[model samples]
Target: MAVAIVRNVRPWGGAAADVVIDGTRIREVRPASPAAAGTDGESVDGRGLLALPGFVNAHAHVDKSWWGRPWVPYGGEPTTQGRIAHERAERGPLGLPSVDGATAVLREFLRHGTTATRTHVDVDLGVGLRGIEVVREAVDRLDGAVDVEIVAFPQDGVMRRPGVLDLLDAAAAAGAASIGGLDPAGIDRDPVAQLDGLFAIAERRGVGLDIHLHDRGELGAFQFELIIDRTLRAGLQGRVTISHGFALGELPEPRRLELLDRFAEAGISWATVAPPATAPLPWREMAARGIGIGLGTDGIRDLWSPFGDGDMLGIALGFARLHGARTDGDLTAAVALASAQASPFVHRDLHDLAAGAPADLVLLDAENVPDALVRGPRRALVIAGGRVVARDGDVLL
Candidate 1:
């Protein structure tokens, strides 16, 4: 049976139409009918607002954020290793990875019109698999208002910490969508051993690998090559992703182009948080070569840093500003990278406001995609899985 009808909405700033929903999928989109508008509870009047697919957060850290809790001052060092030490020492006392913390952050994501996400949950020896469990319970608490794909992340060193591989394997076997790795060469100090171990586990468990490569310059480029070679060897093409690969934009032109070609051949994808200080990515070149790029809000108010707000629109704007997006087409593309173009990151074949796609969408009172990306006004309505989940910046579920 049809759940609801969103009447008189302009999809992607196009012609006004009526979007019909049935259960968890979009039934159809047809020309608006004057007689179809009703005050009944089964229909929602869109008021000709701009409708877009609900945002997809390609990369996120949802487990450790202390949102909705009393303010915890940022006392960690600036470097990567320093932050890791600080989190390990501080998280235990704060009761980090609790269901309440994860639920609060997820609610924020939903209130910002994000309907789905690919979140990295911590899986170290201290917490073991407890963090993953907390995140699962948090998602359930929302009654499926937000869809989350889990990545069992070894935030600490993987090779240096023995028995972590077994934990990752257990996570994969227990139905985690993918496994994550941190700076292998920089943190573990043994690039080959770390990469080989992660690849081995991914291959054996039939899961994907999403590694965090924070090593910059030639060191980072070298690790990229290793990942490409290993991906091809393990037949894991299209199943591997590199998060925060800051070196691709810093390499020399010739070397960078060469690596981009190889990356395309190996089906490697890139996820970035679009920090202001980093070099602009060669997004045009990567797009020409058919490489996928997805944007994310890394971590919000977490032990790592006191930044981010779980808003995908803000991340899209940062990406546009970083890449110097000016024209209308480029701005629209930037918005796409945050919504429709991010399907593969969350293992979705299709996530849009069209027929046969999941009925996940956001309605904003803006002129078009460019206006929405620039202003990022409160979402007038948010529908997930053919159900109304949020209204006017408030989460209903």
Candidate 2:
């Protein structure tokens, strides 16, 4: 753990600094000086490289991520409901996405500097927990290369999908990281009962919670309130997340402010995937109010979404475009959303370059992060847990 000076390095900001690392921990960052010392240790030449906290993808579906699927590319040219309908029809019944497909997707993320990701796994009935287990194993196989957090998700209703909750239990027992529920409305005729059951299981298990909200229009009202109450009762707001709560920004102005204010107060964070089609993603308002925000690819290279390239930069760029915000601060905030800070669920200390933090990191081939993200650099060297699992454009290869 002696001094290792990485000189003339471009830290997250554009300013070049002389960074000193004591073993894997970054000891100091200061303006470059002639007297900066480099000791006999691993030397990382930072010239022509950008040093930033490795990117974190707050939300993603790795197993369901498909490439070359029969889906139109993101942003339909027609830009109307009819066009969207036609696009869906063309894609046909979506093929079952698998862990094999996810390998390529994981490499793509690492290749672009996203070293950490929270992936939701499909725990539907017919498939059992095999798909999620497969994904978990793949991520475990990449343990030294990239950080992937798996969520045991019941895409089918927890109550309606007989034995699904039991499957979730088994997943947790089998080392699946978190518990997830999707649209309790899909669970049964009784929405409240379904969600209550799921939350009860989560409460008993002491696992993190991530919920997908598909309630469109008026139906979301009851579902949202119940979710908030359940999270409150669980007393794990710090460990809970709500993905795609799009309707939050769609309510009447006063109502929107009230609920979001509550969301902020509750220690809850929202996962902004498609940027809320109902309203501009509430970026400015949420940050100003201290609400934790994060970004996700949602569905990568799939019929559900063709926008993802397994890159967090793409996720942040989409956020910037959809929200109409631009500034270094905005980019910084966007980066946090893609990092561990984005979710209340993940417990990793992943936002800083420091000693003792796992060497889960990314190196970008650019001058600095803001500009690098703007260029969407493809050259990335990813180190996960002290091993160079991804390098030379074939991260995890």
Candidate 3:
């Protein structure tokens, strides 16, 4: 039975059409049939709003946020190690990594039209997979309205922290889609050992690796090579991602091009939050080389920093402004990176406003894709898995 019909909407700013949903997938999308729209189980008149696939948050830290609580001042130091220590010291007292906190962050995501996300949950000696459990319970609390993929992340140094590798392995065995590493050389000071340990676990457990590489310039590039080598060695191609690889943009053109080729060869993908003042990525070249790029909001209102709101469109806009996107094509590409192009990041084979795709979409009152990308107006409605989960910027679920 058809669950719903979204009437008279412009998909990607195309001609008006009615999107029919059956079960959890789109059944069909054909020319607008206003008369037939009245027969739907749940009929939503789109009012010719511009429709887009539900936003995909490729990289996030849902477990770390303290949303829905009173504002906590940023008390962590500026450096990564300092922030990690601060979080470990302070999170316990604040009841961090609770289901409520994670749920709060996810609800904010849904309210902003994000239907799916790939979030990294901290897996350190202190937390000991408790964060993962919190995130899982939060997802269950939502009852599948938001699809979440977990990456058991070693936010603290993987190699330096004893027993963390075993925890990561345990997480992989317990159904974590991917295991994460953080700054192998900068934090662990042993890039080779850290990468080798992570690769060994990934190969053994048949899981993917999403490593955070914050070491800038040559140091970062060196680790990238090490990761590339290990990715091919372990036959983990197409299952490895480098998150916040700031070095890629900092390198000279030739060096950057060389690494891009190697990254393509290793089937490595990238996830970034597009922080300001950083070098702009060679996104055109990466796109040409078929390298996948995923955008994320990182962490929001956490012990790390008191920023972000879990809005993927705002992150897309930040990416556009950072990359100097001015033309219609570039602007639309930015939005696509936040939606359809990010499908792979969330393990979706396809995610768009078309037949056979998951019935997850957002409707905004805008003229076109570029307009939506630039302004990022409030979502008029959000359909997730054929159900109206949010409307008029309010999360129904």
Candidate 4:
């Protein structure tokens, strides 16, 4: 391990300090006023900049980065809209090639100081997770530049896809971080059975679980209960997650509290994507009650939303715009969902330039943390495993 100190750096917009990077760890962080005596490797004058922990996009779908060419319909929306448009595309014979779609989007994420990202790639009908193969290749190509984890996501109904569970296993074999599935309702209106099978696949294969439940109206807690229950019973409790369970829409106050209490017990992490746009503030209330809310990009550049810029700055802005975190503390919790407090889920020591933590951090141009999200990912610097992978608005890979 070697030492490289950054002087005059403000982490989390606090006072100036020297951040020591020793090997792949943030060795020690201290106030810089006294002019610390020890020096070895190199000293970078981190003047007028904020040092931040790398933004870990707990969720994303990089394959759809260029779905909108201003011509085709959209992606990952309500099936009706897509089906209707599919006919139109079939008739008009228009399509967006997946290979060329995701190029610039990856660069955009790096420029915005996103060092690590976990993306869900679809393995549904007609779509064979081919894009995942491309993503894996791209991630390898961009290996040192950015950290990208691929999840074999069954964007559509899992059971509906022939051999979907098997394919999920294959995705795991291909190094997907977890196995993913969509609403149980769409696959046969039987959320439990399909979810049970999916979780079984996870336990048997020893993989993590990331499920999407946009069908809140129909599935509701019935689906979530299954994920929670299976995760607990299999002793894989904290290894699972539930995404977009928005159907908890304005959950009755009593039920909301009770459900959150149970959710905390189950140790299931919540994924917040498209928060401002989706709504139902009981979510914030739930988080306050000890529920873990991990942030994700959901989809980057899809047809339905057309807005994901692959930069988590947009995710935070979208959240703050809708949620209104009045105080710095409130904003702290909101941003914490993006990283820290994941605890037993992911990135054990994900935030802060804390010692003994993975050296994933950002150098921001913004005045403060919350201000960074609002002001846009500014003058970003990304460091991963103690290596300066990205800077000066360039994608090394």
lDDT of 3 by residue, 143-259 (tens): 888999999999988889899999999999999999999999999999989998999999999999999988999999999999999999899999999999999999999999999
**Residue 138, candidate 1: alpha-carbon lDDT:** 98
Q: Provide the overall lDDT of each model, using Cα atoms, as 2-decimal numbers.
A: 0.92, 0.67, 0.92, 0.67
Tens digit of per-residue lDDT, candidate 2, span 1-397 = 1235556666665576666555455566677766534434455455536766667777888886566444545544543233334334543344454555677677777777777778888776666787776676666665535567888887656776679888888777777677887777743556787777667777777777788775664576567777778778878676677888766766777877777777776677777675535566566787778777777877777645666687787777777767765787776666656664653435675456555554555667775556766777765556554445566677545
Where does model 3 exceed 4 Å of error? 36-40
Query: If ranked by TM-score, best first, what sequence of candidates would result?
Result: 1, 3, 4, 2
Question: How many pairs collide in each candidate, listed in order?
Answer: 0, 4, 0, 3
lDDT of 1 by residue, 1-397 (tens): 1247899999999999999888798989998878656547778888999999999999999999998888999987889999999999999998998899999999999999999999999998999999999999999999978999999999988889998988998999999999999888899999899889989989888989999999999999999999999999999999999999999999999999999999999999999999899988999999899898999999889899888888999999999999999998999999999999999999889888889889998999999999999999999988888888889998888
- The TM-scores, one per candidate, come to 0.98, 0.83, 0.98, 0.86
lDDT (C-alpha) at residue 190 in model 3: 93
Better of 2 and 4 by TM-score: 4
- Considering summed lDDT, which 10 consecutive residues are worst modelled in model 2? 79-88
RMSD (Å) per prediction: 1.2, 4.7, 1.3, 3.7
